[model samples]
Target: MKTNTEVVTAAVVGLSGWDALVERYSRLVWSVPRSFRLSHTDAADVYQCTWLSLAEHLHRLRDPEALAAWLVRTATRQSINVLRLRGREVPPDRWEPESTLPTPEDVAIGSDRARRLWAALTTLNERCQRLLRIAAHSPELSYAQVADALGMKVGSVGSTRSRCLAALRVKLEASR
Candidate 1:
């Protein structure tokens, strides 16, 4: 099997590599919405949208070797959009059963300690929140990929993560 780097490199060379690109990155693309705990239907929508986005911008990609990062970033954004749109929908009647699908927030903040951590997380600044969330959720992503996703300098990711973690610890302690 071709590695991700190889696949992306091939894909960038010509339209002939389109199928290889899709086959290679499909799992990575699908996992984003699933990690967000989007329903199967919603996840399918996100998966399709992410691939469509890649197809639309394939020829114009600034760094074709970074295709995985691009796909992940796109999927994450699409998942967030789905959640936002769902939020604006009319609330179900009291008799209706709650959605079986957990929200992204719920997926991240499952345990009691996690709930506390999440509360602390909410108190942090937007940058910290974003960085930590991306780091926490996308463990498979390299520092470069995370940096690309967040539009940060690659060297800054570790330092920023450390600082954000320190701030989170402070908040966690304060909440006690």
Candidate 2:
């Protein structure tokens, strides 16, 4: 009496279900790095390591129902470890400041400059804040996708993002 989905779901309750397991949990794995404050490259590394660790823990997963939670927890721990390791590694040549952009001391990570910028973003109206947050999620910001995700008309995305960035900038300068 089981539907195809139910049969597949049953297969996933054991070793024969690993492919299904990977398919189901992949997004959860990806989301860990996506939601985390880590950089994109760092997030990718964390995602990969999370899967590797999951493979090791496969047989030990006491509850198959807990698979999603397990992937997220593993990804988080791996991200923290990677972040700690990065703090000690020498910076890459390409990691140098963008000459066209602001100076490193002026706008480096965790600097007052970045903090003020983020604080200003919080001053935006709720919708604008969410739009900008979604836009900022990936290195390559996709206004169309962001609008879709936020339930906005795609046609309005470009102007909305422009306005949001302008507002953010004004707030930052005002704070300065």
Best candidate (score: TM-score):
1
State how far residue 142 of model 1 sits from its true place (Å): 60
> Per-candidate TM vs. native?
0.47, 0.43
Worst 10-residue stretch by lDDT in candidate 2?
1-10
Stretches > 4 Å off in candidate 2: 1-16, 94-176
lDDT of 2 by residue, 14-36 (tens): 66565666676778898887776
Identify the candidate with maximal lDDT.
Answer: 1
Q: Write the per-residue lDDT of candidate 1 for residues 22-118, one digit (tens) a residue.
A: 8778889999999999999999999999988887787678776687889999999999999999988876663455686777877866776778998
Superposed Cα deviation of residue 143, candidate 1 (Å) = 64
lDDT of each: 0.87, 0.76
After best superposition, candidate 2 residue 132: deviation in angstroms?
48
